[model samples]
Every structure is written in structure tokens, then in C-alpha cells.
Target: MEVLGRDVVQEWECSRNVVPSAFDSHFHLDRSGRVLQVYSLERLIGHAEGPVPEVLVQVSDGVAVFCDPATYPEVYPCAPGFGSAVGLHPKKPHASVEGAVRLVEEELRKEGVVALGEIGLDWTTPEQEWPLQESMFVGLLELACPRRPVILHLRGQDRYSSEVSALSLRLMRENTSPTQRVHLHCFGGNLDQVLGWSTAFPRCYFNIAGSVAQFDEIQRAAVRRIPLNRLLVETDSPNRRVQRKWHNTQAYVGEVARKVAQIRQTTLDEILQASLENGRLLYNL
Candidate 1:
């Protein structure tokens, strides 16, 4: 692919020989093992393989999800560059707690499986379902080993609710060890929440997604105040909607890193490099 009249792949290949490539720390795939984007980059745009210099991000490092159980055997063995996690997402109403636990336990034994989550509580669900969600979350937490990172998917009533945040912190503290590495996927917490999680688990890394561009004041403050070492970047690709039908891709992770750099008053390369290192450490990439 070419960007701005320059061949991006050639440049990426050359630069990658010298420095580490940028990592898209989180993304999702459908049961068919295809990236969950509305428009296929290769069909709509030009070749979608190259990472552009616009934000100096490169190829994927890891942290993509096979959201469906059936995709496990078919996808993981073939996908060489992706590190996956297997857990029931809190918002998935169709997933049964017992079945989810069994599936998670089975997948965690695989070599390609790197983390144990995108699991937690979603306050937007009916209050009666909270116990079910908590039950699955606690069961998955029991399977979390300190050797692998635990990626959390947390949501509240709105962008500002602390109810889910506080509850998640409490649950994690009680269920998981302080030494367990944690990945807070698509983090949008306030500074106080950041402090709360960091105080409890110093190894926790907060992931800032492409939605960083839409963050409110408190969310942006949390990003700015986040420790440099604890910072990570993700595309959460195919999950971010740019328009009515168009969805973002792994390339958007670079854009997120750019916004993070601007927010932290640091260089773009610094953010990208830090994220690459942090992701490698967290996911054992």
C-alpha cells in the first residue's frame, strides 16, 4: 500500500529491521475468523497490509479476540501473529456461565491463548442479570494465572458511572492476585478510578482505544495522568464506528497513539514505542 506517494510496506519493512513495530493491543474477529470491519480494506481501499507513516505505527503485535467459541480450533492454529483471549463478554446475554467457564478453561490451556478476558460487569444490563454476569466473571477470574495477563471489559450506566468501576475493582481484588498482570481494555475511567485500580494492581496497564478522540474531560484527564509505563494502545478494531456503516481497523491504533501523545504532551514515537514494549510485557508477545 502507498500513502502520500510513498510505499508504506517497503518503508515499514525497512524501519522494522531497525526498531520494533507498533502493536494493536486489542481487536476482534468473527466466528469465520475475519476482522469485524464493515468495509474490507483490500476491496474498498488499496492493499491493507502496510502500516502508514502518518502516525508511525506498524504491523499488529497481538491481542485480537475470537469472539465465538466455534472459531477457536479454526482460527488460533492458523493465525500466527495474533494472541487471543477466551472469556464471556459481560454484555453477551446468550453466553451461559457454566458453558463459558468450561470453554475458557479449555482455551486457556492453548499456546496461542495469551490472556483471560474482555470479561467484567456491564451496568447497562438489567439489574437482575448482574448476578449472572458477576458469576461468570468470578469463575473466569479463578482461572486467571499470574503468568498471563487478564484483560477486563468494564462498562457502567454511562460514560461517567462509578458503580461498575468500583464493583469491578473490588471483585478483581478479591478474586485475582495483586501480582496478576491486567489489561484494562478500552479504558475510559476518571483519574480517581485510575488511581483505585493502579493502587490495587500496579501491574495493570490501561488501554486507550481509537475512541480516545471522543473522550470527555475526565476521561482525557485520566489518559494524561496515566503513568507512561502503564500506558497501552489498541484499535479495538471493528468495534469503533466512524460513520453509519464504516468501522475502524488496526491502522486506527496509530491514530489513537497520536491522540495519546498529544494528550500526554509527549512525542508520537514515544507513545508508540512505550505501547509496543508495554504490550509485549503484558501479553508476553
Candidate 2:
């Protein structure tokens, strides 16, 4: 099996241009079972239109999708196309941090759960919710270790500051080991913050989203500062839409790759190849 896997990976590497797909490090398929994005995988690969891409890692909130075991398989079945990351969302309701930690730990043991994530801090929530959020985040991080890689959904207190990032980093350092793989989802911090994270958590990765197209100089500078090997691309689909007509999808990941390549002064294919490998390494795919 190991030899066969190696052969398959070699084949993928050989035909770089015709690799058939690009990995989307993060995305969400509607829990309601509605396919919001118009583009299909077939359309993406066949036409090469509107930035062709594929869903490699589809991360859904554990509380939202894994509340019921029976529906969980039907809602998020792992197939040849993509894998799933099931973890608690910071915004999802939980009776307590202990319950959230127990639930996430159970879900991590399930088959097809590639990673633990869509977890972390969201500062937009009410001040009273902050305590619960921090406690839950710390609990999840503790349970995540000696297990799967984590996907963090960190949001700043407001547009001007990275207070949430600072708090999240502190909790992560306290709860998680330095070797534990972490991906900061839909990152929106400045270059200095990115540099600090890179220095503090060497195993950490940053994901670029379609929303980056609207970034100011600071955010774009952060993109430029991200090392190629520590970068991944995501759509955060059905949300973080780039434009009115576009419902973000894995197909739009190519747009993010393009933006990153531009910021790094490199080619799109180079960024795509590096990010593909980064996603595989981060998720152990």
C-alpha cells in the first residue's frame, strides 16, 4: 500500500500542469445539503475557467454537522474527491467547554475525519461569551494534541487590531505542543503578526482566502511575508464571497493562488504546487 501510494504521488508530480486538481485547504458544504456554488469539479477541470480548483479538505463545524451520528455520515461522507475536518466552531453553542472537548475528541476518532478544526476565537461575539470561547478553545486545543492537525478560525476584535490573534496565540501556546500542526484559517492580520506567529509556532501554516482580494497594504504585506511552504489556499465557501455574483467555492481557490503568487512575485503554478504540498503535509493527506 505504501509503495502504491508513492507511485500515485509520483504520477501526480510528473504531470504538473495536468495534475487535474488543486487542494482547497478549507471550505464548507452547506449543512442544509444545498450546493450553493454553481461550478462543479467537472466544469473546473474541463474548462479551466474562472480559476480551476478542487476541494481537498472540507472542514465543517463539529457541533453543527456531528451533533447526530446517524446524519453525520450522510452529511459528510469521505470520498475519492475530498476529506473532511470535523471540529467545534467557536461560535457554535455548547453546554460547556467540557462537553465541547468530549464531543471533539470523539469525532476525531471517527474515520474520514482528517483534522480537527474551524475552531478558535471570534471576537465579534458578545463580551460575556468571551470566557466560554476562551475556555472552549483551550479545551479543544488540549484534546487536539497527540491526535490530528488543527484548523483555527481566528477573528480580530475589530478591523484595526489583532487582539483576537494575540489571545488565540497565547491559548494555543499554553495548550498545544510546538510540533502540533496548526493552520490559521482565512487569516486577516498584518505582516508583523504573521512574522510573530511564524517565529513562535514554526509548525504553523496560514491560509489565504478569496477575501484577500479586498485587503489593504498591511494584509497584502502579510501575504508576501508568508513562506511558500507555510501557505495554503481556501475559499471558506458560501461565505467570504469575493463578489456579489460569486458564491465562494473550491473552484475559486485558483484566484487565491494567483493573488499569493503575485504578492510573492512568483508564478501561479509555483504557488499552486507549494500550497498543494503544504496542504498534504498539514492534513497528513
Which number leads on TM-score? 1
- Provide the lDDT at 161 for model 2: 44
True-structure RMSD, every candidate: 4.3, 7.9
| Distance from true location, Cα of 127 in model 1, Å | 2.7
Least lDDT summed over 10 consecutive residues: which range in candidate 1?
A: 38-47
Which parts of model 2 are misplaced by more than 4 Å? 1-20, 35-75
Whole-model lDDT per candidate: 0.72, 0.65
Give the alpha carbon lDDT tens digit for every residue of 1-285 in model 2. Answer: 111101122333455555435677776644323443332332222221222233222221111123222334533445453567777777784797787778767777777777788788877888899888888888877766634678888885676348888888887877878777788888878987788788778888998888777888888888888888998877676456454244455445667777777888898778777877887777666
Tens digit per residue, CA lDDT, model 1, 126-234? 8999998888888778888789888888888878558888888899999889998888988988999889889999998999887787888888899998888999988
Worst 10-residue stretch by lDDT in candidate 2? 1-10
